[model samples]
Target: MIGKRYTVPVITLAATRRDVYGKALAKSRTEGLLPVVVYGRKEQSASYFVALPDFKKVYREAGESSVISLKTPEGALDVLIHETGKDPITGEFIHADFYAVEKGKALRVSAPIVWVGEAPAIKLGGIVVKVLHELEVEAFPQDLPHEISVDLAGLETLESQISVKDLAIPAQVKIIAEPDDIVAAVAVAKEEEEAPVMDISQIEVEKRGKQEEEGAGTPEQGDQTSSP
Candidate 1:
């Protein structure tokens, strides 16, 4: 089991019932509201709106894996951030999808991996390589963890490594990934010397100089006298 758990922040959103397509969506952005949809077990998919700034704050803290409570007109809903849409030009949030989750229901989600403590091998010129960024886990909605912590302090030598089976998670949570899958490792950092860059213009000038020297050895047509 994890030694410490992060507190997931709760965010409230006002339910919107207005049109969600065409010009209405553009207007919603101008008003600082983002269009969002919520759907999941025991509920029909519904369109709604949330404050953009508030949602962005939650996104930065909770990310997509952590569960957050969404307050709708119906009541408080436990949900996970399923996905989000961004504007390509301005890099702004455009839309969001929240997956409603029921308490006591088991669901599979990708939990992010967080590395803690510096590997002792790093001081010996060893490079720390991350073998996996996230792990697939199944747990009840309330038991879902925000992130899995991997302690690098155990890596005392370059040959030391950690695998999925080494992770300490809550008993309620089950990692779906293979136990033999490597989570991280420390290895000797490969040092490569930079190769000298050749100057194309210098090479071209040298070739022209050689051609001129060869031409000088052979008399020109006009320079060729009767003694040719």
Candidate 2:
């Protein structure tokens, strides 16, 4: 089910953004609860929380990178991620930030950027500089795409700069970004130094040697390494 694409409903949040809390979110989600805040549609602003399992289903269906529908008990709406918080101690979910979406209206979303072809510069010992990891696009919900990829197989020199206009975008999808936006390019490689790996035995040998030099007895050594 995870491998295949699916569309899951993200229910509108009932409480206002200020009303949401950390502990409440974790408990609600763990007990088959879903929590989200939806505010948009030009004054149709209200937050509603959904079931956790249902929300997980949506995340499973849509790559977290893509937008999904938020079907509310009151009405259905479109929304996307703003942020998701994690627990400090246990590293569990603390909260999620959501923004409402309106179809046919321009919306800004962060979509992934990909590389299409093998880099010619890599073969030439040149470094590839990926300046932008993601792009903020202005388009409708349906128009919003999965990802944008740039080819590097033809790039061999640092003089070339690949722009957004060079991307082979779909006819239905119009990139709201500038055509000259450089997604990635090749650069000259810098010399690097290698560091030695400190093995357990080597570390113990060094420690024992230091201890003896300082008039301390050597450890009865058989490789002092601890197993997890």
Tens digit of per-residue lDDT, candidate 1, span 19-87: 567676898799999998899977789888888988988887677776788878778888889999999
Candidate 2, residue 106: lDDT: 65
Instruction: Supply every candidate's count of residue pairs whose N, Cα or C atoms clash at under 3 angstroms.
Output: 0, 12
Q: Flag regions of model 1 displaced more than 4 Å.
A: 1-14, 190-228
Q: Write the per-residue lDDT of candidate 2 for residues 53-119, one digit (tens) a residue.
A: 5555555444344566666666555667666666689665545556666667766667677777777
lDDT of 1 at 114: 90
**How close is each model in CA RMSD to the real structure?**
6.4, 15.8
Error of 1 at 219 (Å): 26
Error of 1 at 216 (Å): 28
Over the full model, what C-alpha lDDT does candidate 2 score relative to the true structure? 0.62
